[model samples]
Target: MNLRVPTAWFLSGNRSDSNYTVGVNNTVVGFQESEDLRIAHDVITNSILVLIILGMGCGITLDQFKLHLRRPTGVAIGLLSQTVVLPFASFALAHSLGLETEAAVGMMVMGVTPCGMMSTVFSYWVDGDVSLSFTISILSTLLAFGTIPLNLLIYSGSWTDKQFVIPYSSILVLVGMTTMPLLLGIFIRWRLPKVASVILKIGSYAGILLVALSLVMLSVLYPFMYWASWKIYIAAISYPYISFMFGYVVSALFKMENFRRRTIALETGMQNFTLCFAILEASFSHVTSDVMSVFPLLYGVNVRTAGFVFVGIYKFMEKYGPKPVLTEEAHHLKHANNHRESFRLEDQQTSKGFLDSEAAEENGES
Candidate 1:
């Protein structure tokens, strides 16, 4: 395989020495990419991906799915954010930052991918609507077949060369792999609730493990020079929060409840970087894939960190924040309780008076 340095290296004025030394500001970073290492990474990561999707599938039920279909506003808004708003935001960010062709394409790819299971986890942690989160997650993953290619067709032209081909076949394979496990999980949930519960637990742990492993592998495999780039770092750190903000704002604008807004925000922000990795691996050159991979790795770390912070803040507020006022139903219930207590007190007083009068009458008769 011919190894061509990514255009990002040239744009940043960095050069590769004969020994593949990547340098910036007199700092040297070096790493060798072997086929075996790539194969190992792919196998491990893909397994984790399957487990994560399966776990998420187990969380869904036909009832919850049909309920969302009946009330489609929240789901529709979430889909809009995931499919439309996110890609446009990424494209604008890339252009405004004046990123190189490869890096820009990476941004768009991350944007267009479906929402990850981590968002459902985050929604649960933050007191968001977990059911809505699950609903959006499965729906977005199923719809990714069309949305991924459509977004790429619309946005890739501005960032990619004419020779760049959209890997429709690879995309189809990915969609199939993701959906089949998800459907299987749903089946398990429907037929064997106990087994689905176990799988859900396993999947949650696997998802956390996947994040840790990805970070570690990225640090070891990718050159330090890529991490040192301020442009990529800024883009990665900002992308999730920006996407999150957009989701919240749009949902709020549509008058969604707080829990639904929170769910949508997390779904919008925490994208399936695993899917992005698979796409890059299958579609791009090795060198370019390596270069673009850095963005998602950095993004995965930052998004998780920010999500934890948000969860912490939400928990704190929920525990110590101002109490919400009673609703009409609660108010009526409270009033009824008070009235019942008053009636009990009156009955006790009347019984006491009658007993006193009866005792006087007995004394007079004696």
Candidate 2:
């Protein structure tokens, strides 16, 4: 097997003394490639750790989870879209694009992974249903063990010749990673709000820094992925957009309100790519793992970039777009927000007046 150093990898400045023979799949692949791969892998490992901590510290609360549960219908629909629609869409997309075996598996892993905490952040930004987003994220994560393995087995069965074992143990690790911190955070929020707030502040700063480092590592890795397999890039770019649209259509068909539909769309589109990376790394051979990582890295880049653009569009529409014809429920929520704003202003004015009177009293005494 000829293992050419991909043009992109070669273009990324040399960090080693070793020279690689292009197109030879020798056991001793170049140190440079190994070194780059190791660095990227380390970055991913660290980022996952940070995100786990961050998700626990700041991403959710037990109350938020319970609130979502109060309305099971919407949350159930979101879960269906996540576990059923997204994986099928990914499998179909990979098949249609003729992605490499490893790449196809990577895509399926990404599709099957739970809704990321970032979806809730986006939901809050867009005035979407935050409870729904949180609910979908938490429930999907809790159920990922069953859904992930089943989806992968169903979708990628054709591609692998060996009896590719789904590592149930690793799924346990996933459950622990996602749940332990989450429950701890909820506990902190409930009992020690001050401590939780401090943790949230620190976690946000650290998460941002680690995320920046991870992006840099991924950017370096991207060029090394095959130019010949341009289809992977096409798939990466299109997958999230399609997922978003699919969620909207499904939600609309279910006759959900507009905000709930948008919430489902964001949840469906944003997956836990970090978890995908962890699963592939743990389950596959080194070479196969490296190859599989390409799709996730590409997706991590594309989804967020595209999501941000969509978020901007959402914000613009909220501010300047024609008023949406509101249902009674929607009208009630709008009136509630307006009422809250008025109360806040009145409180501020009362505080200001009290402070002024105290100051005047002090001045008279002087």
Candidate 3:
């Protein structure tokens, strides 16, 4: 979508500096009430989510997923990191920081949710195992159906007074939204490889577009939100890095390979904001939902920025670090060249021998 909503909201002569308040009521009041925000949230989030899912499917293959399907260790570790370790970390961080209830709940929701598509994007760029990333993402998403509601019940008891119910319909929407496009992309890859390749290139750019779209949506949704509080920023900055390290260290402890470690790290660190938003919309009143959304929106931006930093570091290392070994095809080509050189040497020796024999015969005749 365009930035017209935010621009119009800005130009409508309703701008007030005092509207930026720290209270949850003040921060999210405009968002809950704005028709523009509701529309933008639905349109922008869904579109971006679909594109991300499609891109993820385009990059992965059935062959690459064989290990996850069989052994399930990587998927198990990844799910544990996200569902168990990350959520506990999120709760601990938020509680220790003494954040407001809504903010704390937001962090927990982000921690409990599935990994975002941006993780897969980062994995691809950083030369991690894309298949492993996708596998972990899908498996975590499937498991979130159970773990998310359970987490909400467990962590939200102190935060929310209202009865929390798991909204199965919204969960189903998340499943369909994520899985359908993924399956379609996989089908295209299997059947129409050329088409899938083109789509995959386009999908790589989805991250940038989603970021821009989110900024616009947030601008329109909460034109007066005071995001300047150091508390939220502290949580945002610390959470992703902690989650990354947690995944990496745990994977290493479990004897995962380097590439899988990187993939798991990214997958664990990134949370699916769109899915979290959807759940918020389904489970709470507009006011409460809007208040909760601030956490995910801010977290999404910060985490992706960190992810890109990871990508840049990896690109630099790939360019300047030790070079990769030759592939099987390269080895075959080298062997063929050596064989050709040997045959040429043999021909030259035979020609010299024939010339010597001719010279000797001629001398004998003389």
Candidate 4:
């Protein structure tokens, strides 16, 4: 369950360098295939994914979800912003930027995938409404199962130029890989809370190591990738920052509270990279390898870096920005003090009464 994010100091370095090409042939493992390194990196990514699911599962609870139903408008707004608005925006960005078709498709897929596990972490960090964030994340992901295929078909309709067709066999791929695991995680969380908690904690620590390992790879890998990145964006790294500012500004234009604003910001900024990666792995074939049409695997690192950057930013912002109200915490502190005072007063009264009663008894006996 250890799925810590890869480190993202690279966020500030230069996504625009276009110096780092991520083509199909450009294995992230570097020039030499080094099966050992490839296996290690694969293990890290898989662990990161498992940890992410575990953390998300641990963050969720079924008991009080119904309470939010009474305030359906907010829920609706959160949902609409996520599933509807976000996908369209992602498409627009990719299309207008004139991204290669697969890149555009991949970016759009990232948008459609829904709020990430980090949304909960960022929500809590930014003092945003964690419950609402979790609720929005879960609902949007549930909705994605139906909407993603539709979006993919619509956007990539002409893929082989002969009205490209899906094998329908891949539906099983989507379900088995993404949807089923997610549901399994949720079921475990609901039915076996302690197990979920342990998995989630492990995932969190794993995520940290993943981030560290990613950062190290980027440092070692970038200088050699100059040949492949000829046409990709020189400004791709900055997109996350721009996206954050835009989402924050847009959320603020509405009358949202501090925490909700944080939720919107982080949710809006981070893409679900795993979804895009899974689709590329599943849908594309080896024959189309170089002309494979999907983006270079290096983009995965970019996506991870962006998500982690926002998480760190949020962790810092949570301190100065809005926070969850301490109603329960305050109530408990007050109750404890009241109980203590009551105990002290009762002890004093009992002691005086006992003393007076003993004197009276002595007088009577005398």
Error of 1 at 96 (Å): 1.8
Candidates in order, TM-scores: namely 0.74, 0.70, 0.75, 0.59
Task: For candidate 3, write residues 132-231 as lDDT tens digits.
Answer: 7877877787787789888877877767755655566756676787678888987886677566666766776776677667767665565533343477
Which is better, 1 or 3, measured by lDDT?
Answer: 1
Tens-digit lDDT track for model 1 on 253-327? 998877678888999899988678777777786777766666776787788878877788778877799865644
Candidate 1: lDDT over CA atoms? 0.71
Residue 176 shift from truth in candidate 4, angstroms: 8.8
| Ordered list by TM-score, greatest first | 3, 1, 2, 4
Candidate 4 lDDT, 126-148, residue by residue in tens? 44554566566666666666767
Q: Which stretches of candidate 2 lie over 4 Å from their true place?
A: 1-64, 167-213, 221-223, 226-228, 325-366
Pairs of colliding residues, candidate 3 = none
Ranking by lDDT: 1, 3, 2, 4
For residues 240-280, could you state the per-residue lDDT of candidate 2 as single tens digits? 89988988888899898898888899898989886787777
Report the candidate with higher lDDT, 3 versus 4. 3
